[model samples]
Every structure is written in structure tokens, then in C-alpha cells.
Target: MIVEHRIYTTHPGQVHEYLALYEAEGLAIQKRILGRMVGYYRSEIGGLNQVIHLWAYADLAERDQRRAALLADEGFRHYVRKITPLLAGQESRILVPAPFFTPTWQD
Candidate 1:
């Protein structure tokens, strides 16, 4: 599996608005294209005003196809236009799990 970690720095005092918009609009549109969400987060440390989310894909090719489909979706495009101005900076990383890792179960 491939993992995507997206980190966003929101405008000062805009965390609440950003989360609300994401829940009400962004997430729904994302679900339509991406299908499953691994996790979403708001940082309580590391200088604040940060939002992070993780997504899992079957492979790099699958990730590319799904992400491109998402960007082409009209609803998602509209949300991007609305939310882009609220962002300070964004970063994304792709990760691979260790050989022994099991994402669905832990011990």
C-alpha cells in the first residue's frame, strides 16, 4: 500500500473555519473520488494552526488515478477554489510501510 500525508498550514484564526469547511464540503467530495480516508488531524503542538490528513492507496498508479479524478471533479474543484486562500502553505509526502506492518490491526 501507499500512504499520502498532507499537511496544511492555515491562516491565523482560521482553523475552525477550515475544519468546518472540510467536514461540510471538502471531505464529502474527497470521499466521492478517493473512496476511503485513513485519518484526519489538527495539531495541538508544532507551532499550531496545522491540519494533517492521511490516505491510503493500493499503489502508486492507483493513487495517481484517484487523485487526478478528484481534481477533475467539479465539486472538489469548487472547494479547492474556496479554500485555497485560507491556506498558508501545504506539504505532501508519500510513504511505504515496513514489511511487518499491519495497518488494520495492532498488538
Candidate 2:
């Protein structure tokens, strides 16, 4: 399995606004398409105004397909329009777990 780690740095004081927008508009659409959310988190320490989340996929191909579907959805596009102005930066990483570490939970 592969894990996609996403981090969004919101504009200075806009973390709450961003989170509210995501929870209200984006989460359901993403959950419907992505299907394997590992977790969602907000920064409380080192990086202020940061939102982080993880999603797991069987492989890069599956990830690409789902992401394409999500992007093509009208609801997701609307949500992106609403949230983009609040974001300062965005980063993503694809992670591979070690052979011994098994991920037992998803969604």
C-alpha cells in the first residue's frame, strides 16, 4: 500500500476558515472518491496554520484514477474554488511503509 500525505499551509490566520470549508464542503466528496482516508489533522505545535491528512491507496495507479475522478467532480471543483484563496502553500508526499509495518486500518 501507498500513503499520500498532504499538508496545506493556510494563510496566516485562516486555518479555522480553511478547516470549516473543508469539513463542510470537501470532506464528503473526497471521502466518496478517495475511500481510504487514514486520518486528518490540524497543526497544534511546530507549524501553525497547517492542515495535514493521509490517504492510503493500493498503488499509484489507483491513486491517480481516484484523484482524477475527484478533480472532475463539480462539487470538488466548487470546494477548491472556495478554499484556494485561504491556502498559502500545499505539499504532498507518497510514502511506502517498511516491510514489517502493516497498516491494519483504513477509511
Candidate 3:
């Protein structure tokens, strides 16, 4: 499996607002479409105002398909409209687990 790491850096003091909006409006639709979420986090020390989340996919093709579906979702689009103004920057990365590593969590 491949993991997609996403980080959304919110406007200086907008982290709370962004998180609240995500929890209320974005989480459900995103979770339903993405399938596997490895982790979700907030930066409390070094990178204040940043939200980070990890999603797992079977492969790049699956990632592409699901991301495309998410973009087409009206609910996600609505959430995007609401969160766009709160964001300062965003980043995404793809990760592959090491040869000796194994996931412990049940899927």
C-alpha cells in the first residue's frame, strides 16, 4: 500500500476554524471516499496552524481514482469552498513503506 500525506497550513489563527469546519462538513464525505486514513494531526509546537493527515491506497491508480471522485463530490466541493479562505498553503506527498515494515492496525 501507498500512503498519501497531506498538509494544510491555515491562515495564522485559522486552525481552529478550519478543524471545526472539517470535522462538521468535510470528514464524512472524505472518509467515505478515501477508504483508509492512516492518521490525522494538528501541529501544536513548531508548525502552528497546520493540519496533517495520511491516507492509504492500494496503489497510485487507486489514489488517482479516489481523488478524482472526491473532486467531483458536491459535498467536498462545498467544504472546499468554505475552507479555501482559511488556508495559507497545502502540500501532498506519497510514501511507500520500507521492506521490513508492516502495518499493525486492522483494516
Clash-forming residue pairs, model 3: none
Point out the higher-scoring one by lDDT: 1 or 3. 3
CA-only RMSD, every prediction: 2.4, 1.2, 1.1
lDDT string for model 2 (1-107, tens) is 99999999999999999988899999999999999999999999998999999999999999999999999999999999989999999999999999899988843
| Strongest candidate by lDDT | 2
Supply the TM-score for candidate 3: 0.96
TM-score against native, each model? 0.93, 0.97, 0.96
Put down candidate 1 lDDT per residue, 3-103, tens digits, no spaces: 89999999998989999999989998887788668889999987689999888888899889999999889888899998999999899999899999878
User: lDDT for every model?
Assistant: 0.88, 0.95, 0.93
Please report, as a residue range, the 10-residue window in candidate 3 with the lowest summed lDDT: 98-107
Which lDDT value does model 2 have at 46?
100
Instruction: Say which candidate scores most in TM-score.
Output: 2
